[model samples]
Target: MFSRAIAFIAAIGIVLTVNKPVISQNHSEHHSVPSPSETSAERESSRLTESHVNEGLTKLHQKNYSGAIESFGKAVEIQPSHYLAFTYRADIHRLLKNYQAAIDDYTKAIEFNPAHSYLRNSRGVSYAALGDYQNAIEDYTQAISIYPEEGAGYRHRGAAYYQLGENEKAMADLNSAISRNQKDAEAYTIRGEIYTNLKNPDLAIADYQQAAKLFLTQSNREGYTKAINLAKSLQQQSIVPDSK
Candidate 1:
């Protein structure tokens, strides 16, 4: 059960940050003003792009994943530099288990918005899903470098390290993640597994207890149940005599 829970978390626990659309304003004060015709054309393009984006979002909310991808693709066609459209398409691709396609789209998004840490993190998740932990680590590292204050990057990188059998590195990264966000139930859960692997059942149980509490607070019944059960199982094992 514990192993299955770990796999479940690994498969679905990757966080994707959605950015709201920002209204574009004229920046003539800082840069040379465009010709009236150019400005008008730009406005038309922006309007079309926004229309497609809205349509895509509506389709996404309806669970019409393929329709949403089509709409987002149109937005990209209308505005090749529309990173958000690429991101939306990539998210759908990832949901469909098309990891390589998701990675490609995410790479395009990152190329247009290099400073967006969440984009890198999302790309890393796709890479990890494809079992390319090395590439995943690189993307996660870039995300951490872009926004070291965010715990998601550290948490993800820690999980990748854990998969690579680098428990010490995983522990360090998970510690960093929990330090930044004590309410991070996922981090606690992963850390608990690390402790269990290291033969520290006491610490593992403590972490699981904390994780269970956090998960319950977050209304994640599945996570809470898994954590609490793991803690109880460990407790029972600890009380039993060694077979030797």
Candidate 2:
């Protein structure tokens, strides 16, 4: 069963669910198997776990999030300590808008693999969705500490900081993210929002325009909509009544 589970998880791509400002986390290259010296029972258990995980992945890809959760539950039942199962299950819960469930699953996954930066970053997103900015910041910080060069963690942390009214920190993080990933449309959009809040209409408009262009290149309707709205708002704000 364990062996089957391992195979299953590996057979299907792991689906990740990250909220706004993070897009998604993909760790397709992280799959690995235990040493060959492991007992046959262990291998079987791994196989079972993999099989269920694959089933869950299939459901997730089909957008049947509830069914995916059930499949992940089965995988977890077969191997309680299976970190990826917990992470994938958490992802499904997020997709279902079950924020608490997602947090719980992410917690379990974190306990099993504390060094998994992607899981930490994803969990931070779950916390952010719940309006727990402090927790979200902590998780993003931990992920940054683990993987300093990762732009996603910093961008997420920046978003959390912005929510917490820490404009300076947010700007710094957004700048860092933009430095790391020049083509990051989300980063530009987020930075534009921060600029708007700072009352810097010129900078905000520039950033929004860049974001809209990037979104157009990527065919992201949502980003384009946000950019258009920001641009319109900036334009209206610029046309102020003259004092006689």
Candidate 3:
């Protein structure tokens, strides 16, 4: 989820992040979710808007990030309240390292679709990247309150807590992340790092081992190797502490 949050819209860069899953707007529900279908026409106008979106996606796939943004911009301009275009454009901005712009577009997207937790989390991740952990924590807390079943929110909040050196709170949040999703490899990995910071190599190694196994199960070989290597390195450090 961090990768989803942090990884560019298409794996374009490396940094801290959360997952950015597409927000699912429930059309069948009676709730106040805004539907673009309501605003857009079925024949000519809808075709044009959809064409722009498709072109944007194609540009994104071609690694034409700026062009993709422009196309999404056109889509939104056609339907000023197009939620998907705003979200996609925001993602491109985030991937392009335009954090503030991404935040702005994410905000607009949220305006059009308020109940989507991933959108909130995506904005929080950008806020965190900009060194605004308090705001990020607020966003994460709100998302978690809205969707308690989601582990990504907990993982993000835990990481933000760790950033503020609130190790106890971070551990509690990390535990929640694991409880919500037993296969949360990043939570285990991060908790292991926290245990390392606490100077408890035994617990650290255990967590790292779990993360490695989970990553392997998730077919994330790179993550598995990194966690395993970290565990091995920690074991060596445990065997030979630094001279005081």
Candidate 4:
């Protein structure tokens, strides 16, 4: 349930970036032609790896976090350098509430291919889970630098800032996120919190109202209740004085 709450606040917690595979330096340039026996072994290994990866993904889709993790673990063992496998396994770990293991897998993925924006974002989120706002911001910043057009990186970084008590920075990033995607209810909620912290009750109420409206339109009763309660609480606190 808490995982769902965090999922609502952030868009899947990590971005997946496509990156090239890393072959070991031991791969010889003057390699001899593989024998039929060697080819058979390689094919078997590849088949096993594919089977495990597919099983892992299927389990994940079914919300079987533990099963997914186990399958993914087998895939990683078959091919230790599989960057995508590590990234995927990390996602499963997050779903399972194993934040540290998620971070470790993300790190391995990064080592295999450092240029992946999605992996950076995933690692940043793991760091955020451990209350390492500085590291999380760094990862988010790198992700944004790699793909500025994607709103997810900025949104994640804003969350990191919010966690760090840097409300101004958080607002700046959240505003960018909303500008990129106006229908982002999560952005509105975060911006609302920033406004509330700034003592701008009117603006906070307005944002919360927007969020509530969106939630209602989407038939999201829980989200609507959250936003509505926030707005009501702000009003009760007398965010605005009587003009009279």
Candidate 5:
């Protein structure tokens, strides 16, 4: 169920905004004008890469996943340093359950854009999907190091810790996540599971109730239904007479 909760979030695919590719001017070329032919080739490559990225986005929007991957692949082939192309391709691979392919693409993306915490998080998700919690935790840790103020990394790491049966570490990370963002429905849901495992039904039910409220607010009907049902189930159990 915790895996389902995480999967729900991942199901909402990440759509990276596209921008016109800008050709980076080389410092060495500043002193002397490039040959006209070289300049034309560079500009042409940029234009083609931009066109491919835009086409990829359109295909992605239309749910033409294979076409989207092809287009993104072309973009990256034209410009190997295009991190956005790598990222989009990685997302598609992840959705397709090609976890290893997704990790490979995400690694390429991270190489070109190391400062992006979301890239690390995305890679971690793929790693987690493969049941590699240790690698997932490492990626989440990097994401947290890059953006300590954000709650996503903490929430992700908490889930990974939970999977590894490190409940105390999970609790700490989940607490940090909730402290940073009280509206994080997934964090509350996960924390509720931890409470249930600890035999603290009162706290667990309370967390589930809160998660239901937040999930409703976020228009996550599935999550809201799950949380509310969990809360009600716990409530019913609490009132049940003990078997002598």
Candidate 6:
């Protein structure tokens, strides 16, 4: 489905950061607390959850997505308020095409850490996949506002604009992304598509050419084919102007 900007999607699509929760202890409270054994169990649970989170990171490195998901899920079960666990688990759900489940986990994570802009960006991607472009734009806009220097935020937002048939907005955002990140072949490719639709064959050819070169450099066979094929077609069309 996303055969065009595979690398681009991988860049801005996932939330992998683990947040360390702060637990403040109150020594002034005279009320009763948990028993010593109960405290031990709580400590054990926290330790085990940390272990699970570590194992999940290892599984992700090994490309065992399902195993990673299981580990993160276990961490969430051990501590439902574990924001990182929920965020990681939500990413797995998103990769597995479980959009609603991913949204739920992301929502829970956002509740725990509302200041993170990328969380909104990641959740926005899921919303876009489910044909919720409006929500995706909202999240992307928030992300842009939060981190104006982030090029990927603009890239994804441009794609969403293109999907919504807002070529002008899409092109503008893609231009911003490309100007900031020269190596962003995905942004070039997407902007090329926008140019093609806007009847700017010369600009499309330029973008597609750059996209193909970048994809080849990245060793992405699918992106190479997509860009090269479109570029060639556009080149041919440009060779023959329409008769007035």
- What TM-score number comes out for model 5? 0.85
Q: lDDT of candidate 4?
A: 0.75
Clashing pairs in 6: none
lDDT of 3 by residue, 15-101 (tens): 233433662332123223445666535445656776787687677767798898999898888877788788878877877778999
Model 6 worst lDDT window (10 residues): 18-27
TM-score-best of 2 and 4: 2
For each candidate in turn, give its C-alpha RMSD to the true structure in angstroms: 7.5, 5.0, 5.3, 7.6, 7.4, 8.1
Better of 1 and 6 by lDDT: 1
Better of 2 and 6 by TM-score: 2
The global C-alpha lDDT for each of the candidates, from Candidate 1 onward, is 0.81, 0.78, 0.80, 0.75, 0.81, 0.76
lDDT of 4 at 212: 93
Off by over 4 Å in 6: 1-41, 241-244
What lDDT tens digits, residue by residue, belong to model 2 across residues 72-132? 8998998898777787788667766788898999999989889867778878888999999
Q: Rank the candidates by TM-score, best first.
A: 5, 1, 2, 3, 6, 4
* Regions of model 1 farther than 4 Å from truth: 1-39
Runs with alpha carbons beyond 4 Å of true place in candidate 4? 1-38, 218-220, 239-244
Estimate the TM-score for candidate 3: 0.81
Give TM-scores for every candidate, taking all chains together and pairing residue i with residue i.
0.85, 0.83, 0.81, 0.78, 0.85, 0.79
As a whole number from 0 to 100, the lDDT of residue 217 in candidate 4 is 89
What's the CA error at residue 18 for candidate 6, in Å?
16
Report clashes for each candidate as comma-separated counts: 0, 22, 10, 0, 0, 0
Error of 4 at 233 (Å): 1.1
Q: How would you encode candidate 4's per-residue C-alpha lDDT over 68-165 as one tens digit per residue? A: 77997998899788776687778767756788999999899999978867778878888888999999999999988887776767888998899889
Backbone clash pairs for candidate 1 read: none
- Model 2: worst 10 consecutive residues (lDDT sum): 16-25
Instruction: Judge candidate 5 against the unseen true structure and give its global Cα lDDT, from 0 to 1.
Output: 0.81
**Comparing candidate 3 with candidate 6, which one achieves the higher TM-score?**
3
119 Cα displacement, candidate 6 (Å): 1.8
